[model samples]
Target: MIPRLVATDLDGTLLRSDGTVSPRTRDVLTALETRGVPVVFVTGRPMRWVDELHDDVGGHGLAICSNGAIVYEVADRAVRRALPLDRAIVLEVAARLRAALPGTAFALERTHGFAREDSYRSRHVEPVGTPHGTLEEILDDTVVKVLALHDEMDGDAYWRAVDRLVGDLVDVTWSSTWALVEMSAHGVTKASTLALLCAELGITSAEVVAFGDMTNDIAMLQWAGTSYAMADAHPAAQAAATHRAPGHDADGVAVVLTELFDLP
Candidate 1:
């Protein structure tokens, strides 16, 4: 069956290991567009990171950013919908996180961009090109996500710590070794975001094919009609997927697209 819409996570699902979409992937995506299959990117990254991809995939795609905090229309570069964090709750969570991990670096994600305290440099010194702003100033705005950096924190420990600390107050997930905790007003997730997108496109969750490689992608994977986990995906993700595909380096998404959609 031809999927009416295709929704995929970006970092470890659609892009190759080097963090760029391969030429083969690009060709498959273009062919899907030609076949009238709407391609949507569901990611934990902010929309600012979507421009580079928009250029590659053309400006007609949709993006679910900040782990579903915001859905953007690439054609007009506008936010179609947003689920913002409650200022009071977010400020409280930030305070608690700071108290728990004194030396930890952190960033507050807004619909437009992300901000970090000057002290962030002491811990997460890696330059990811995300602009920095004071925590106080960021709290004054609508925060969509929070990223915490711990040099020695593996994915498991990171998730455990955040879950124990925040619990149901926020949604915690990881890509690589970085811990990304997304706080919403109450309940918001990639699956919910995709549901909204599916409604807009007249598609159903049963018509969507999703992919991923991390704990963050779990909800969406389970919500899709058929979900695929990468060969190198985490155990939880692999268990959640309907099927397992090749590793990201082996063009997992491309392989599935070719077989399922019969792309050239």
Candidate 2:
């Protein structure tokens, strides 16, 4: 059955590991749009990253950004809506996390730009001297995600430690293996955002298809009517999804799309 909507993750799902979108994948997505099937990019990525990429994949639509904390209009780079973690919640979580996990550094992903503690080394290229201060000092009117990383923890240990500290307080998940934990409003996730958007569009979960790879993408993978986990997807994602596609580098999404829609 043809879906009314299709959703996909970016970093390690839709885009190759090197962050390139294959031409075949691009064309297949275009074909879906032409057939009146709306495709949504549901990712943990910030709106800023959408501002940078997504143009290559017909980004003139709405995107679920910041792990459902933000709805962004790709065309104008405007925020349609934002479900933010309350400032109080942000502060409280940061405090608890800091005390429980020594050497845990912090950063903020605002609706507009980025902010981080002086101790938090940035992994993304941001404008010079991006706001630097305590998490309390750097906070703005709207904070979509609170990014936390440990100086030592990198993979599973990092995930386990952070998850233990605040998993009960807010929604916590990770897209990368950098000991980074992305926290949003409690219970907010890609699935939450997708469901909200589908409601607005008058579509049903049974009418949607989704694709993802990481833990951050798991909720979305489960929520969609038909979902695919990438060949290299985490074990949890594989369990959540209905099927598996080839890895992103192989244009796995494109291959599945081609067979689904029979696009030339």
Best by TM-score: 2
- 9-52 per-residue lDDT for model 1 (tens digits): 88878888678989888888888887888999988877777766
- Model 1: residues >4 Å from true position, as ranges? 122-134, 179-185
Residue 3: error of model 2 in Å? Answer: 1.0
Q: Model 2 misses residue 73 by how many Å?
A: 0.8
Listed per model in order, the count of residue pairs whose N, CA or C atoms clash below 3 Å is 0, 0
Tell me the lDDT of model 2 at 33. 72
Summing lDDT over every window of 10 consecutive residues in candidate 1, give the lowest-scoring window: 119-128
lDDT values, one for every candidate: 0.78, 0.86
**TM-scores for all predictions:** 0.90, 0.96
